[model samples]
Target: MEIQENAALLLIDVQKGFEDEEFWGRRDNPAAEENITALLDRWQETGRPVVYIRHDSVVAGSPLRPGQPGNDFKELVEERRGKGTGPELLVTKTVNSGFYGEPDLDTWLRGAGIGQLVLAGIQTNMCNETTARMGGNLGYDVVYALDAMHTFDLTGPFGWTATAEELTRATAVSLHGGQFARVVTTAEVLAGASAS
Candidate 1:
């Protein structure tokens, strides 16, 4: 895997709200935060651009809603803010796709001359996946860091439930091989960075 020197690391919806197992069922990828933190550190160290997306849920009582403690970024991610030499951008969005966020992610990326994106964060099949698809469609090289993302179990309309691990695997299958993004492990991405 080749990661461009200027590729922006998009950390989507890595907030404390995702830690609420009571609100969001059991989740897969227990080490997701550690992986994300590692990638963030490397990107900052190498001076690669970084973007953080926060989901501000519109649902009246959602954990991610404004004024909720869950809306804040996790401590590890928050600690690295403004520590990187590369530019940092924060995008707040109510929708699943980070591209639709305020200040306009696409516009910001375009203005910054970024044409490649590396994605990681919460909800493997939700915000992260949606953002990857959008980034691909918009002609950016999108890399999906599978191991750096975690997702909760989901229940369908028919009441059939899917395990978080199953959903995460499905997300990887659907996004890999030029569909929406290139799905790779966190180590793979970090190695690519180191190689570059």
Candidate 2:
């Protein structure tokens, strides 16, 4: 598959709050941040457009609450934002899908003429997955950078616990091959970026 020259990189909810294992439970993909940084760096270097999605949870006791320290972006991502090497858009959301965020992700992408999106960030099975599905439905080419996202273990209503790794794998399996997004590794995305 070919990546568009103007494909936007959407970094969803790579916040400090996600570091709280006590709140989110055991997580997988320890190198997620590093992989996300790699993709961000490449985008910045190429002067590609980037959208930063922040989740400001309204749920009481949520670490991602607006006034909480955990609501801020991770240090590495924040530092990259400081460099100002590319076009940066901020989308703040209370929900899982970045498409439903403040400033209107779809409108902004349309106005900017970006038809393809490369996703990388936190909660592999939640925000990232939801955004990819929405993006696909909206007729945008979506790329899911699987290795660049992580998720915490989740307990189902039926009382079974699914490990983070399992969820991540399942999400990839469900989304790839024209289902919703093209699920691939960070290295593959970077290679596509370079080639595009």
Per-model TM-score on C-alpha atoms: 0.97, 0.96
Which window of ten consecutive residues has the lowest lDDT sum in model 1? 171-180
Candidate 2 Cα misplacement greater than 4 A, ranges: none
Task: List RMSD in Å for every model shown.
Answer: 1.1, 1.3
Question: Where in model 1 is the C-alpha error above 4 Å?
Answer: none
Residue 183 C-alpha lDDT in model 1 = 92
lDDT (0 to 1) per candidate: 0.92, 0.91
Q: Residues 161-195, candidate 2: write the lDDT tens digits.
A: 89999999889998995489889889888888883
Cα deviation in Å at residue 170, candidate 2? Answer: 1.1
Q: Which lDDT tens digits does candidate 1 get at residues 62-179?
A: 8999899999999999999999989999999999999999979999999989988999999898899899989989999999999999999899887798999988888888888548
Candidate 2 root-mean-square deviation in Å = 1.3
